[model samples]
Target: MTAALNIYDPSAKPTAGPRSLAGLTRPQMLEAMKSAGVEDRKAKMRAEQVWRWVHHHGVTDFEAMTNIAKDQRGSLAKAFTLARPEIVERLVSVDGTRKYLIRLAPGVECETVYIPDVGKSGALCVSSQVGCTLNCTFCHTGTQKLVRNLTAQEIAAQVIIARDDLEEWPTSAENRKITNIVFMGMGEPLYNLDAVSDSIDIMSDGDGMAIGRRRMTVSTSGVVPKIQELGTRTRAMLAISLHATNDDLRDVLVPLNKKYPIAELMDAIRAYPGLNNSNRVTFEYVMLKGVNDSPAEARALVQLLKGVPSKINLIPFNPWPGSPYECSDWETIETFAEIVNRAGYASPIRTPRGRDIFAACGQLKSESERLRASARKG
Candidate 1:
């Protein structure tokens, strides 16, 4: 009889197999296939076939590509993997919001969320990094230590997994349940620019998933250097997580503000490509009670955003365990909104969604990974 090896052996070595193919751009896919011994002409053909199966059909299995020859399909499957990181945990809100904890590699995990609403559009909130570097005071994802960046395939798989749950397959230019995607789940997207850019390119390609560039928004906590590149390259709507109005308070609320102050951040916003009345930039202002949601602050916000064609999303603070902040009073938030509205900015108080499952605007955590890590240590 063969001896059983210890499953929990810490020193057990792992072998590298196929890397993820989730985030490849069309040109990258062609290059990858060509390098893997596929002929140039056949590489293009195979890339299109694989793209259709992966994006349009949402198939993760190589065998599902019916058009590809059986032998080629087997060989491709052996050569390259098309699987998402294992989903570690899943949470569903009372309002049907779904958040998934996905494991990218050993000891690395990230969170992704799916928000559902009737008659209107739904959104998939994806993470760019396993943990966040910004450490925004209002966000739970910021509480964890910064892990390595997720690959483009890992980023793209968040959408694929959402589509898998929603069953919105055979992607088209119009009419889909996942109407929008927001890179506001875990990490600062600007820190993981190359992968995020590559993944979104595949998502926005007309021949593939074809999600509208306008419907997609990449939220940044004022990463000044890469802001223009994001606008010029992606053309996706821009959303800045501007929690505080002044530099001093913002330096605390968003730690990155210490490096690039509000002045520089706003300047970058102004320099963003295609900023106009029709394509107004979105400024996300989280309302914290007594901290930054005062009527004076709201009016200052109006003055602060002067000459910039923009709207504001007033997000009431969503509290979590051991958080330092509290949500602003309903009347306080309303009064604040009124001040901005009177100043010609469309400041809408965002309706709280997915709070029951801790999937609200600022309430996302990856506890499953923590538990798994603990188990391994124990």
Candidate 2:
């Protein structure tokens, strides 16, 4: 008879510290259970129970997993941890938008924003990385250098934290404040694909967060190679940060366009899997004054997106300190929208949300640097 190995031996010094089980997918969680000395036959069942508790019930404490055996729960506590990123600061805008400065680890922070009344339901903007690699000229986050990619657990924790704040527990549809999630925060998501994909899977799990795949959109700044891969892996709604209509201007606006120009980006968009009229791709156009918001540019945009099912999201430029561009005048924006609207595409001017809190589009920068600066002053 083989004796079971004690995974949580009190006197034994652990080789590695406890692993966080928060953001793990079902398969990954099963593997973790097997690693923790759970029998192969029971690992899947055990992982399902734990997954329901951690994600569905939003229980952080192993002791609260009532269905799990006490001995196993104790073992899980020793072998794993369920934690969300620490909320260093949470600011609520007058418009009911909430921005969280979440500290992933010491000195590593990211911003998550909750915007109310998107499609009559609230939406949470989640970050995939601590900072961004793309130096999109107008973006505040681009000014900050890349720190590191957030793990799947860190990404999923943003949703968990927001749900906790909203008091939308038990995962009921009626009380759901955050029905949609947009990966449009600090970092470029395609750069951190695996973690983002896994995190989305966790968020969209029917038994847990229960957010539909269609309600979750992953916005990319045209990472060409990863576009099709993202479609295959996540199958979530796609949004492009398409600020410019032409390559020359786009090369300056979004530097990634230098490598993957408008033509290549359009090609990738055309090839995206599961794209149809109902699941149209979104082209986010920030209306920069005297930049990319002309009637000719709008006509050019319609021409470029020809035969592609898409919607144009005209965002008024949200200014940050030292930003060179200004938002287009309301009349100019309306005219630009008219061209796209006349072309049979929906072109809605996105109202700036969380602007007071600096949580609007292109305004997410970590507070860690500011906090460090203050510490140095003292």
Candidate 3:
């Protein structure tokens, strides 16, 4: 018999110390303040004031929170920190895609990406784990060993750090460019569900960044167990990293399929909370040269996703060093997309962005560890 799983309770009280503002949700902050004896109405007023300054105004210093009493600011600063992850390196692609290597405290790091397109809707890809544990065969991120799960502070900092570089204020909705957030950058988002949930809540809260729940997406590579809870808690759009069709091939492509299998994974996906035509799931299929790019495979994909309300994102394989797969020929990819389109599913062939700087899809590797390795040898 299998042992019971130990899931961390997110609602537990935070320990007293230097807590980062990036980590706390609006409610969590309120709770923290109350725990620290800010339970009365005046205390609640102080909590709201601090929340607005930290999130709405994007104040990096507690002292700059002018609305709060001067004495309270000093006390808050002594107890908490409005800290952001330091950018160790920032690279911008010719296509306006920007990738940042952010350092989280000592010996911790992650990458975040911003993709600029024709529309005002740009996507910010955020990382969940410091390194990936899934180790999907075709992904470059899977090459590195799993370091650790990013804290809620680390996860939230990715958004704050991006907004800082983009000069984005929550108030400026008219010229605001970043319209979407995707947990598609580095590790498996499901593995770090607590942090991902907490971070995204801050992103979607109306009083702060104000991104709609529908605009946020959490991508998982068949972490079946967490799918239902994720749908219930966040209710953001769900995206599954479903690169292959059959269990036999999927086991090799995405090794997690070996444990969960397609049948079990599909069962969980079908039962996902808030699933309907209005809130459809996305199936991301990366087309490899002659491997999974055949018209037959496309038909199989349509059949597999029969009852689900979904859009198949037909992605051409983005190659990296030592990658075994090559992108499918344009004609092959087109043929494959035609089969799915005819099957009444929207199969948009995703355009590869930031390939020049390797910031495109499936090409993110943490420069944090690479730089450290180089420094040690020197």
Candidate 4:
């Protein structure tokens, strides 16, 4: 077994002292204010004021909250912080995709990617863990062993850091650059359920980040038991990393399928709360050449997803160094998508982006590890 590198030391202190206000929800913020000596009647008001400053205005320092009284601001600053993860490296792809290597405590790093689309819109892919536990053969992150789950603060910090980079402040409904958030980066989000949900709650809070739940997507690699819970708790968009149609093939493609097969996964999806035509589940199918991208597999996929409000995203396998799989040819992917489209599913072949900077789908792995490996080799 490959040993996990750059794992977070749980015993180490996360930060110097003060609690982070970045990921706290409204109620949590109010409670925090109360604990910090704010009166019961004034706690809610003070929390709201701090929330607007930290999230709405993207102010890092409590002193920047100009409306708050000087003494109150000093007390709040002494009690809590709004510090985000330090950006160790920021790489901008030639095609306008920006990948940030964010450092969460010492020796803990994860990557967040921002893919720019047409107009003032883009998607931010955030990581939920320092390293991934899932060893999906085709995934770059899977090469690293399980490290640790990110805290709610760390998870929400990705968005805050990205917003800082984009200069997307004042939390606008119009002219938004980071319009969508995908829990599809470094680690399996469902594995870190509570933190991920809390971070989502903080991000989707109307008076703060204001990102609608509909625009946020959580992708899981068939964690069946958590699927229903995720839908009920978060009510955000759902996507499955379902590269294979049959259990026999899926077990090999996604190791997690060995525990919860396709049938069980489908059953979980069917029972997902608020699942309907408008709120459709997405099935992410990475087209691996000569593996799970045949026309027959597409037919099986359509049959498997029958009666489930869904769309199939056919992704061309993004290559990484030492990866064993090859992307399916364009003609092969087209043929496979045609079968699904004919069966009434919207199977769009996802155009690969940020390939030059290794920021495309399935390409996020921390640069710290890569550099370490390079150093050892040298």
lDDT of 2 by residue, 1-378 (tens): 221111212122224667777767777788889989999999999999998888888887999999989999999999898877689999999999999999877778999999999965899999988777889999999988877877777788899899889888768648579999999998889887878888888999987788888899999999888888889999899999999988899999999898898898899999999999999999999999999988999999999999999999999999987899999999999999998999999999999998999999999898886556569989
lDDT of 1 by residue, 72-168 (tens): 9898887788876688888888878898888877778888988876224788899888777668888888878777776676788888877877778
In candidate 1, which residue pairs get closer than 3 Å at backbone N, Cα or C atoms, i.e. clash?
A: 23-153
RMSD of each: 7.5, 6.8, 2.9, 3.6
Q: Which consecutive 10 residues in model 2 have the weakest lDDT in total?
A: 1-10
Task: Give every collision pair in model 3.
Answer: none
**C-alpha TM-scores of all predictions:** 0.90, 0.92, 0.91, 0.93
Highest-scoring model, TM-score: 4
| Residue range 1-378, candidate 3, lDDT tens digits | 221122334564335547776556777787767766665776667777777776666788877888777887787777777877689889999889999999875676788999986235798999988778888988888987777777665677788888888887653457777888999988888877877888888888777777788889999998888898888889989999999899999998999898889998899899998889988899999988878888889889999999999998988888987899999999999999999999899999999988887888888888866667569989
What tens digits encode model 4's per-residue C-alpha lDDT throughout 185-272? 9998888887788889899988889989989999999888888888999999999999998988988889989988899899999999
Stretches of candidate 2 exceeding 4 Å from the true structure: 1-17, 371-378
Candidate 3, residue 251: CA error in Å?
0.5
Error of 2 at 368 (Å): 1.3
Span of 10 residues, lowest total lDDT, candidate 4: 1-10
Model 1, CA-based lDDT:
0.82
